[model samples]
Target: MNPDATTTGADAIDEAIASGNDFDGSPIPQAKLGLYHQVMGLEAGRQRSGVSNTMRSRIVRIGAKHIPQAELNQMLVDADFAPLKDKEIAFYYSGK
Candidate 1:
């Protein structure tokens, strides 16, 4: 069996979110969908520095929601990306 054939727990949840659906299979709110599409469209058109920079951006954007600052910082360092900047720390961790 291919391990990727079945997704469970958080992986399934992430897939659902990426599909713009809820656990019950209902569509996400139109307003949120609209905003998401708008942002993603902008992101698609934006010029990227490179794959590593894009990876770092994604890590900062999504990891901040799930990982503690210290752990996320360590992960970035281990990945050979620069540590979080002051603005990122202020914006992402300031609410805690």
Candidate 2:
């Protein structure tokens, strides 16, 4: 597996995700949004392979750039995710 592609632990996952204003709160930077998209895309593939929720968040936090890991987690939680599952999360990244 690619070093950039891996999973994390539970607490770490929860720490990265946000829990306010739906989807990491508004006002996401465009460039970071793009990075979030890329990181998430990679995460989606890993989710398929059985990585833990925390692991997923950690990977994006340490390896990728877009969408701050905390925000991503917050977004996921906002979307009603209590744990990591093999499902895609949506982030309407506006180029603001």
Candidate 3:
């Protein structure tokens, strides 16, 4: 895939959760939550810049080879909550 393509972190995570595969439709391993986290975290960090081509490519290859549907779904939920939890903690601390 073109590195220049506009692929956001949310886009990648959503695709992984919804499709159980990478954007190219290759299956992702459920065990590679770390990879997903890294990719998603990068996306979150950038906010608007999106996933870099290098990271996107890595995610595609790793996901295609490893993740399963059910695990991917759970990971998706975890991934979704992680940022929220972080925000909650931040807000809590800020009020102190």
Candidate 4:
């Protein structure tokens, strides 16, 4: 599977926020959380399929570019959002 073709978890969160849907006071919408799970599942599948860290980094970079550092940090802090792995965080900040 091509990791590049898959939307990153960050992108999903961004889209969810952009949708203007009510979240019942939650920072993230259910749809966005679902998409984040899906993206992580795809990443795990890619790992199982032997995708390299280099590729993962590239994918993270691409997604991170779409979001500002402050917003990304806020998303990371949201209780409803899954935190990214350290390497993914590193990759994201590296691209910022």
TM-scores, all candidates, are 0.60, 0.25, 0.23, 0.29
Candidate 3, residues 1-96, lDDT tens digits: the string is 333433565476565655556656566677675687788888777745334544444443354345653453355456542222344334333343
Question: Residue 5 deviation, candidate 1, in Å?
Answer: 15
lDDT of 3: 0.50
Candidate 1 ranges beyond 4 A from true positions: 1-39
What would the TM-score be for candidate 2 when compared with the true structure? 0.25
Candidate 2 RMSD computed on C-alpha atoms after optimal superposition onto the true structure: 17.8
Q: What is the C-alpha lDDT of each candidate?
A: 0.84, 0.47, 0.50, 0.56
Position 64, candidate 3: lDDT = 33
lDDT of 1 by residue, 1-96 (tens): 223434555477557657777766678888987897789889889987999888899899999999999999999999899999999999999999
Give the worst 10-residue stretch by lDDT in candidate 3. 80-89
Say which candidate scores most in lDDT.
1
State the TM-score for model 3: 0.23
Stretches of candidate 3 above 4 Å error? Answer: 1-9, 33-96
Candidate 1 vs candidate 3, TM-score winner: 1
Q: Judged by lDDT relative to the true structure, which candidate is superior, 3 or 4?
A: 4
